[model samples]
Target: MDPSTLFAVAPTFPMDDVRIRDRSRETMLRSPLTWLPLLGAGAMGFALDAGVAGFVLLLGATVALVSRYWKKRRPAVDAASLRELIGESNAAQDQELKRIIGSLESKGLPQYSLCLGRFLFLKQKIEKDVHRGQHFAVFAQEVEKGVDGICAEVCREITGIRAREERLGEILTSRQPTQLERLESARRESHAAILHAYTSLYQVHAEILGLGSDPTERETVEDPGELPGQRLQEILGGLRDEADMIARTHARIRRTIEECPPAVEAPRPEVVC
Candidate 1:
């Protein structure tokens, strides 16, 4: 995979009015100015010995008043500020992608580039779909996290491969028969671990692609079918399992390499008298 794929043009959709409304509502709901006054009104009604019915009426009035006040006083969601925040977030993600790709390139592991490329491609695709709905926006963030995890797993696999190669080189040069046998076993185990990681990554990639392919699937549903978010969680969960396996395999190989004794010189054969 070409590292340049990571720099694919981000979707340029302007935040729609619906999304803006959603954002404003979310912000307003979280602010003390929205809820604290309601609480205060309730307290005042109780302190004044208002009956339950009266208190309820007072609280209802307070809500209407609060709503009207908020409608006028709430600051508009500044488009420029939102764009800046998104730009900053995208910049950070880009930096991380570059860091991962740089490490892979430095380690001469270009073979894994395809995995990274597919990840970025799917990520951008999902972002475009997510822009269509406020409900889907959270999935965009989840997708980012999932891609980050897959990229990290790819890096770990590359590191493990490099380490395995070095360890094998040491064992081969040592010319110890026992170590040679152990080396073969380690190679098989490492290969299996790498395969497992790739399988997990491919599964995640396919699932993400599925999300982008079907509009129906992407819809927030209340029925029996799986939700996009739930599927995403499963994908991330698989990636986590693969990561754990890679870590364990790496540690095991390192231990094997370290524990293998240095080459012992063979004693000379004595001639019979």
Candidate 2:
């Protein structure tokens, strides 16, 4: 392996809206530190025949219950499971991005390859941000549902594309006009499908990053869409390592997809503009 061979970073999607913090707040509200004393206070008031005080305590308890009901935050996860899944998701996305990069390189579209790399870096930065106590949920639930399934679909779609390309390869000995048109049509459709896959991939990244705020109202934070030309060239050059790692890494990712459990398909995102 090359010294700079890609390694795993924690894959995180922007799931800031998943209510992890809400659940934490609710948990603390329900903990013994708050409710247990309230219960004790209520009991003591009743024991002393302090009817009005007991009613007040009961009212406080009712408020607490009502607060919990109103929040109704969900997708709660314990700390351990949360951490484990985060690590797993990080690995899955890392591998999948590698595969995508390799496929893009093969298609002679270095700019798109670099675009995806920058997006992956943005995702890595999110994980780093959360780790540094920024918008973090020590007990946050998984963000962006169906992430694994969407990644798996990307893998499956590329696999089909590769198979079709090979079939086309076997029949192209003739220079006949009809054969050339058929091949040209297949190539066009294949590129379109690849573009669609990339569009969905970018959407997944955007949702995880929570870039939903109005750009006109405020200066948006860093964007991967407008990656600088020189920087993109640098990224593409970086992908070409001494060890020829792309084929090996892509193969490993493909084998992983085949060996893993069946992926549940989610509704595909529309092609981005």
Q: Score residue 97 of candidate 1 by CA lDDT.
A: 59
Q: Locate the minimum summed-lDDT window of 10 residues in model 1.
A: 4-13
Off by over 4 Å in 2: 1-77, 96-143, 167-169, 200-273
Name the regions of candidate 1 deviating beyond 4 angstroms.
Answer: 1-90, 93-96, 99-109, 112-132, 138-141, 184-195, 212-230, 264-273
lDDT of 1 by residue, 54-144 (tens): 8999899989988997777655444434544455555565566566666666667676555555544554554445445455455555544
Cα lDDT for residue 145, model 2?
23
Error of 1 at 82 (Å): 7.5
Give each prediction's root-mean-square deviation over alpha carbons: 12.2, 17.0
Alpha carbon lDDT of each predicted model? 0.61, 0.47
Number of backbone-clashing residue pairs for each candidate, in the order shown? 1, 2
Clashing pairs in model 1? 1-114
RMSD versus native structure for model 1: 12.2
Candidate 2 lDDT over 167-230, as tens digits, reads: 4544454333454455455445544544554454344334334433344432454454643233
Estimate the TM-score for candidate 1: 0.50
